[model samples]
Target: MRNYGVVIPAFNASGTIAETLLSVAAQTVRPELVVIVDDGSTDDLASAISGTELPIHLLRQANSGPGSATTRGIAALSTPLIATLDADDLWLPNKMERQIAHLERFPTTSGVFCHWRNFRNDRPDAPEAEAVPGWSRTTMMIRREVAETVGPIVDPPGGRGEMIDWIARVREAGLALDMLDEVLARRRIRPGSLSYGRDPARDRGYLQVARLAMLRRARDKAGSG
Candidate 1:
């Protein structure tokens, strides 16, 4: 059996941390370890998981932002298979089982991602915000070697676009990414989320990542020629 761990990057997420932890605890295929990196949160994030019996490892660092926090958590875990979860999101019960199965079925792929539904934070019971499902950081399960090869996620100047940059790197590396059609997570659309609103700085950061990806691809093609 493959050992798996989960990394959750949280910043002042006291209100949603407990629920997020509960969702992980409820997974049909539970992870061997759950690591939470608290990025200089003033809130009582520790208290949020104190009551849970889950095997959670908590790490704290200065206000370095979500990209740094997630990178730290990934480095701290020794599991061969790793999954990432946002502190404000919820993973469905079969999320781990399905993703792991997909990886096993497609051994050539470096990672597997599943669809996710977006819901308004205030109205969880209401219809999903987006008609079409999509993939996010929380919906991805990747192998350790793949993550190491892709390198650490970039911490953009505005604290967003880390996942976007990482995905671009993955593509540039010619990694085979397998996508599962099933919806495996619920993404909460809240006011203060990292990707809540558009900002010019974030857009510029994405452009930089895209440019880097293009350069990498060009270099690869030249080397092959």
Candidate 2:
């Protein structure tokens, strides 16, 4: 079995899937396994992978939502460590090498999330910025065991914010998390991207995440009080 695995939940990512996998494939510590889950993509995404030189595991399922697709990928883990890269993001060449070193020092830590530049273009020198105040899902290197122990990824309706809920759950369960100072990933922002793009429907995703957080807070308080 490979020492590391990657899971990319893609839906209609015909434009970005190739570059995304290429970025991971170019890593200094290449992932031992690469799993791309097609969430009912109605595009040439399958054809795109057919041309790639990289050997990756492919799985197709109905359009159950991005979160659900990610859940399926998580369920397929067969390595001790797993990394996640979206079909639209790029990983810095040394992203994996550095994150793995961090894990070496913090063996008790369940995952490590690094900082990333958010850019809207493909320019290698494109000026970019990280999420202000904190890091988000764009940067993550997780241990497979930790993810399994926390329960599978939830296929919640809040496609974008499902990560926040999942991480919150992991933290509340006493799993240690480490943040690296290096910018390990590049987030490509397009006009129709779920989190950064215009969306009246996506607004509800945030609300759902916030509501869940509030409920968790209340439960924590009640337990303490």
Candidate 3:
């Protein structure tokens, strides 16, 4: 089995960090290491994980966007495979087991991602809604080589679109990403969450990343020719 580590970039996630950590602790296939990058959060994030028996490495940095925090966390880990979990999301117990099994079965694929469900924190009793069907960071597990090839996620000025940017780079590199049809995580959409609402700046950043990828592809083709 491939050794894996989990990185969680958290910022002011006092209310939900415990739940996130607990979910990770309950995974059937626990990660070799768990690193939580606290991006200058004023909240009691450290206190939340203080008593947990999970092998966690808590790193605190100056106020940085999630992209930078994630990059730092990834750099600190030595595991061959890395899985990311949002501070507000919860992974199903078999998430790591299933993804790792898929990667082991298909050696050619660079990574595997599964579907996710979105649940509103305010409506605890309501049924969870399915996220748009596709590969997402919340449900992604990738080999270290794939992440190194893609490089760090870009932290936009507005602090969003980093994952989108990274995914675009992954595609440009011609990496094969396999999808697992099962839902492996639950995304929490709460009020005041950075990822809860739409932002035009993030949309523009996505376009910019795509444009850069296209330009790079063109340059590579020209060089090959």
Candidates in order, TM-scores: namely 0.92, 0.91, 0.91
Full-model lDDT, candidate 2: 0.78
Q: Model 2: residues >4 Å from true position, as ranges?
A: 129-134, 223-225
Candidate 3 per-residue lDDT, tens place, 74-127, comes to 999999999998898888899999999999999989988988778887443353
Please report how far candidate 3 places residue 187 from its true position, in Å: 0.8
lDDT of 3: 0.84
Best by TM-score: 1
Select the stronger candidate by lDDT from 1 and 3.
Answer: 1
Candidate 2 residues 1-225, lDDT tens each?
Answer: 127888899989988888888888788887777888999999988887776666688999998777677778877878888888788888889988988888887788888888777777566468465443224555777888777778766655546677877888889889998888777788887877775765657667777878888999999999999
Query: Model 1 compared with the native: what TM-score?
Result: 0.92
Candidate lDDT scores, in order, read: 0.85, 0.78, 0.84
> In model 1, what are the clashing residue pairs, if there are any?
none
